[model samples]
Target: MINYNNFIRALIIKNKDIVTAIVFMAIIAYVLPYYTVGGQGANAPSDGQSVGGGGAGGGGGGAGVTGVPIHVVQRTVFQRPYELLPCTQSVVELKKDLIPTTDFPSLVNETVSKFKVTVLNVYNTPDYKAMLLAEGDEKKVLQDPHFLPASATCGEMILELLPSLVPVTNIYDVANQVVSTYHVKVVDVYNMTDYKAIVILAEPDNAITKDSRFINYNQNNTLSSNYTGSGELDLSSGHIAAPAPVLKEETLPDSIKRTFTTEDLKGNAKSNFSKGVDADIAILDTGIDLNHPDLNVYRNVSFIPGGKTGDDDNGHGTHVAGIAAAKDNGKGVIGAAPGARLWSVKVCDKAGECKVSDMIKGIEYITQHADEIDVVNISVETPLSPALNRAISASVKAGVTYVVAAGNYGHDASTTSPASDPDVMTVSAIADSDGKCGGTGPALKAHNVTDDSFAHFSNFGPSVAIAAPGVDILSTYLKGGYAIDSGTSMAAPSVAGAAALIKAGDPNMSPEGVKKALLGTGSTPLTPCEGGPQGYFTGDPDQYKEPLLFRKLGAK
Candidate 1:
């Protein structure tokens, strides 16, 4: 038997042995370990595959050998502003009430024990991580925090698994330990900088309510030395919840709704519905003006660490905010999902561009609180970063729909970072409305501001998902004004709203399914293009008659 006292001192939290816990303990104690593809490969266990166990974001195992391992998410505690509070070990003991002996085994469960996984929302705060436990094991996770590992601060949440959990030889009955379909991993973490710290349960009630963040490196941005976390594991819960719905422009209140005096089609998206309650579309852009009447009601604005309310120090964030789900509460121009919630995870501020690290933090925030937001519209672009990819993937995994604006350069359709990830619906711009006229823009292919059917000065190419009305768009502005702007930046939120609408209608669609719905439901029959040189169709205003297209044109 593994020495009860001599067990590695690595366990930071202790547990109380109750009936249910005893079951788990017994299971773990008796669960025989066979060779599993722990360190590498995929080959799911043949038997004992369980779901709906009521724990973890993905999957886990009781106590048995399967073909694959039980993946556990390793949490790196970070420097949290919250203080960890001390608690009686009884809180963990109470968890036994929730567990049944049938759920686990006997031998181990009967021992002195009290443990559970950490909670999700309570601990990542300011005063929670400072509390210490009586024995250090009784402290609430809200008070505890995990830091980044020695080798890395960013971690990928591929799989939290133990190889022995999967019994290869016994299940497959094959001499070889590999399975045929073992390559489909739930995640990849060798490059993760987030999960390199310790795990802490945030509350005293039970372990399920913990908040785990990377530990603050004693040295800023540096990692620990002895940590080499297992990051290549993968597991899943099968189905994903669908996205939420957003409000449309037509449905907006008359005061805030922008009615084109002529027929301006330049905007993110358009619909014939009423823009419901002005949703708080958090624009993590430059900043927003709280005083602007047109945007004020819609400007459910807030700031990050160094920013302030009503302070759109930079004009970019304000512009994007107007295009997003601004309040439709009898204001100037109605927003996309006017009534949806908006938050500004300001990655970029007075500096003009958000750092790759900060951007991931913002995404992390959205993922952690996806229930509060309707859509996260990212108008800014980043230089390709793997960490962003993981963040985007995590956001989707967490059920947050990420809509990234395609670049405005008529050069290439796509740029970097969030835009590059297909998981993040990439929204491109199309000159649907004319810059000079209030009516719809001249039906042209695409182009810069010049007379020739020129391309946008930004970037362009195949990375473009679907083009929204990115032209001389008139929407809410900072400090009580409506402005006309042109760029792919302006067109993305339309699709974002569309995503919100889809999500609202069916909150069970996968990220891919949401993308498909938008692309699939788009109005087609419009001519391909007519601006490009020969016949490929350059994006120019001269050939702007038909702007909408659909995804299901020929597959029938």
Candidate 2:
């Protein structure tokens, strides 16, 4: 056989490399069962728990079986924690035209779609901040993912849902998500067919402002009642005085004032109309004193936080209530429409300060009761707020007339809200000392306005739809007493009462119809002044004049 040992040696040498490869593969296969990248091993994720945390675009590693190391790569994707994710994208895009585009950062990574889809499952989590805190990197948490930095929330805001989100479920779903994602509390929620919004209370300088969807949401500002007197008059036990100023100025005859006629007990022909019967007027202000006997407060609600009953601790609402519809009960003071039912909507605190969101809440409350409520008296003044304006417009569309105070700053009424809004009936103030239209009455020099003329403190502009007696106005007060106050605040309620009277005449009258009736039947109180030919008031800055409010509309 020839060289058998040499043949065997050559075969062994040639197969040496293949034998070593097989052995290494066997070792790898055995180790994989207990150790793999980011898998269970001596030091890796165990029972679905993460090992170490990483900063943005960082990685971590742990020991594997036999002291070998296994490296794991952390995700590099970053996104706005409050951004609308892919789950809601399709639905949002369907109404893209209706939704305003928020200025959010562009997704830089091409892999963001996959990461966003993964985050959607955890989107409804109760607290993202807590989750990030557990990651043990507060600073990196702000930059990596899950929350906006503390710098994002600049002020308080009201979140407005797209009008197209009319469905209750959809509105709540969006609202809840927003509340959870932003870590903000919903102070109130407003949901109507045409309008949907929520008031979000945030820490100062928070980051929700960075979200594009809330770009239009403005900071919550303080609003206050427009009236200005603090002195109280004691009428607790004395003979309650009739509203002398109001009665003297209201020149409407009986025939014009009567809304319904019926036979008396003596079978004599008589009109039974007590004034504002069957009409409801909601006073949005500091609460009204419910115990005032002269007032026929039908119902009351408080929009102030932690407030229970709508009771006036501040007396402004009571004064306004008295001006609007105290009662014809021959006590305290008679209001413009004394027989009308009154509803106190307390939007302000005991200090007479209210938030813009609270005002919106008050309007929504009135709107919900629109079928029963005929008129709304808003004597508060605020800065120009688009959200407040929208709320008023929604209420007007619901068929309730809105009477707002023009303002007391003596500036352009157009600079304020609700007064500037086109849908509302803006009332300016006139100082009617003698209750007559002629400017012949002695000037109330101390109060800074002449009688039968535009009040020196009243805001004047073309937006003023009507004028009413505002200076030195006598009205019911808290603790079953009476008080004298002045401002466009006092004037607004007079028109509100007139609106109630108009609505009472024809319960089915539209808000516009009621407004038209008041405008059509108003008197020219300034006609007897020096500018009588122009119909403008004495102290008014504008050349154009608004008719003085006269509630009398002769028989239908």
Candidate 3:
């Protein structure tokens, strides 16, 4: 009624003007070369030179600094090689269908024929199904739509995708892009939580874009960085550097006398109260020495394919195993839980390198066989991985208690993985070279420079649940021998062995109950080492240090 047509004409003219201005601005922006300030880019000069014409004085006058032509080297993107899980090729878990026996095989065969994917073997359980498929000529099973069973619902299939040849600068950004663009879904990013940079997968179609800046794929893949060797306790170097003394069969070990005797655990061992007789404890580390005299290794299995034996080529696992459950016979050393059945689940290689996928496989195996296992001892530490965390959490739900190391960097334990994760009990190292128990029966004593103190290399913080003997601790080594090493690695197994004892004491106790019994009863407060490495002491000793691991269980 009030000049509607006139108003509409005015609006159209106004919109046209706005569009013209926007178009003009866009054109200007497109013509101009973008410049970044003091950063790596196409326009940014690699050498230290001003972008503007570089002359000292007046405009276009006198000798000017000649600009060198920048030669940009094109980065090469390598295709990553993925390792298929052995025995069973891919695992699929069904959500709705419990009866996989009837529906799964036909669905798998139909899908395989449809996609021309080859099948080798098939294994099925109540909850999940595993298909052993042949590796295709292209080695990209994930790219095939028929690879996953149509009948299966939500499930995970394991695959190990090697690290890219080039370094992945930003893991989160790259990982996000990879999931969004590629045909595969990334389940876990290895060492992304720490310093080791590798990626893990549930199922991956290697259909990565050729121009992808992130995601390194090297045929001959080495570690992104040098292996830190699990934790700060490198036997070859650092604080605890002395060579391990060779002990005769008749010689009694000091670690047994100090830890067990000091903690009043000798009574339990003598009475056979909590020796972890029927409990199964898995050691997920470098393979164990199968023939160690003091060790009672029940089964040895390796997760690394092409490397089938679970022998301790690297000495760390052997040492950790001995500390957890060496035999109690009148020989070299007795462990915390002397009667526990030991399962050597080798996750790391001979070079002490562990991939995230290998670790997940080992954990999945434990989860699958959770009924038989009661406790798991993980002496290795890495950055937090989502997939690894999920596997561990799943295992925990399946009733397996995980005991992990707090790391040896002598900083905050809260920053490291497994230790950082709340599900697991994180153990810090206490320097008790003399084997004397500090503090009165229930009261915590003040700082004792000559007595027990926190290890200079042990990590501390809120994540630490308890402390154990780790400094110069003697335990079993590789090649049927023994060695003395110190680290939170050593401390973790002491707690693991204690967990086995606790489980043996009360077979019905849950992981939380066991953790409570261990932390709540520990009375010995750790004192800071007076003069060791700089920045080792976290200002408040009482707040940072955890209580010592006491052997007296059922004390409420």
Candidate 4:
């Protein structure tokens, strides 16, 4: 027609570089929007905005970006346009099997999961950090708020995903980022220690269980970490499926009998022994009877949601509290340390059921008041939880002594948390029916345990720190009355009181120092069952030496 072929060939030859440039621009125009549309492009995050999708425990995103931070990318390769829909819809409901397309550096759903995060901040004054220093005005520092209680949620969980797929710096950072991304309603951010555990309520299969931030994640049953974990609570009060056999409860008789365990421990040896005036003991249990006349409760707080008051709906806590620190009043039975201040940290429900997260929260409360609290008496038996252990380790590092029960399971105490932890003192039980040593006490035949002998129901092993009167122990009960009960639960508080007594004498003594004093001054090795074995109990093995609790705190 007009020499069109000739003309096209001439043009290509004249501007070959221009032609190549145009083709390259066309390819870039098509592929550029795919990576830049909703991710790291014009719709990028602003200052103070969190970048990341998925839930708070950091379970979101399909493929990770190499150079870019996982949190900042709006959309990733192969992600869908699910963010366009309302966040209220569940991930399961929105897309059956679709993966997140945008590599968003922001969270998807703000209110993802319920988690209680303990945020610690400095109690600094404008001029100087007085609260941090041990100065003259100690009372002022103790009164200052060291923790800002906060509740947070990440977005909805990504169903059936691997936890290790997403990487995080630490559990604390994950918690803080969740708070920021969700615009969590927090009064203030804590700046107390370098790190504070923020326990998450992740399921066993949740991605958080395998997160990189955790120190130890017990895959056997529960999930725990240096910063987060998940598990339910089992107080092990000789009830339910616990190893401690269930025992019958008895009402108080007309004549309130004197506590024989107190006398046996030499708690009543001196008049001053009845008054552990300088020490404070926190009871983490099913709560204490606030109105009990026989106990001197200093303060009470409950971590059970919707259960505000720290009242003992269950009698176990009340009984345990009385054994530790009943009043020296003439009406009620005297206790091991009658004047020790009691702080009721209720973590169990009315049925005595609890969650490990709640227990961690209680421990957080103790950590916040670590300066004022001297000892913590934990009478519960639970599986080894890294999260719970981490919290206790932090509290112990803050200078709080922890005393836990060896459990009533009649098995090795090495299987339980807190009891298994060597940092804290683990107390086993002794059936001192007459409250005297030498195995001379009466036998509790119905329970098949002899008097003044190693308790048949007490859990033992190398972890058992000490033994005390546990079987048939009578102490304070619910509704301001008295009752008789039995378990290692009773034995643990006895040692707790003894610890309080030691603290009363040496207020600045470390936890290790207190344990040494108890072990060094213990009286009488626990007698084995009659004709059972030289070192072993009736049904339990005692390859290791176990000392009985004795009061010899240098005239205190």
Candidate 1, residues 1-556, lDDT tens digits: the string is 0100000000010121111121232233234342121100012222222211100000011122323232211122221112112211212122223233322223123222333333221111111111122332333322212211011011122222223333321321210111111211111122223222212222112211121112222222233332223222111122233321122222232111221211212242333223553333445555566565445333333334565553665445555666665554544455555545446555554434355566666677667677666567777654455677787888787767777765532334333555677677676554432222111122322122321122343344556566555544445544454444444456666667556656666666666787777666553334321111101113443322222322221121
Candidate 2 lDDT score relative to the true structure? 0.54
Model 1 misplaced stretches (Cα beyond 4 Å): 1-280, 295-305, 308-311, 327-331, 413-415, 434-455, 524-556
**What 10-residue stretch in candidate 4 is worst by lDDT?**
1-10
lDDT of 4: 0.52
Clashes of each: 153, 5, 7, 25
Q: Which candidate is the best by lDDT?
A: 2
lDDT of 3 by residue, 1-556 (tens): 0000000000011111222222332232244322111112111222332221110000100111222221211121122112212211233323334444457677667657666766654544444444544533112344444334222111232222333522545655554555445433334454442333323232222444232343332322353222222111111112233322223343334344444443344454355623335677899887889998778888888987676878876667888888888877766667877757888898876545566678788898888878778889887655455567677988998889999877655567665466677799888766553343421011111111222566555667898887776655567776666555555677888788878878886777889998988776564434321111101212224465566776554453
Clashing pairs in 3: 164-216, 164-217, 165-216, 165-217, 165-218, 193-383, 194-383
TM-score of each: 0.43, 0.51, 0.50, 0.51
What local lDDT score does residue 537 receive in model 1, on the 0 to 100 scale? 18
Error of 4 at 142 (Å): 52
Local lDDT at 30 for model 2: 41
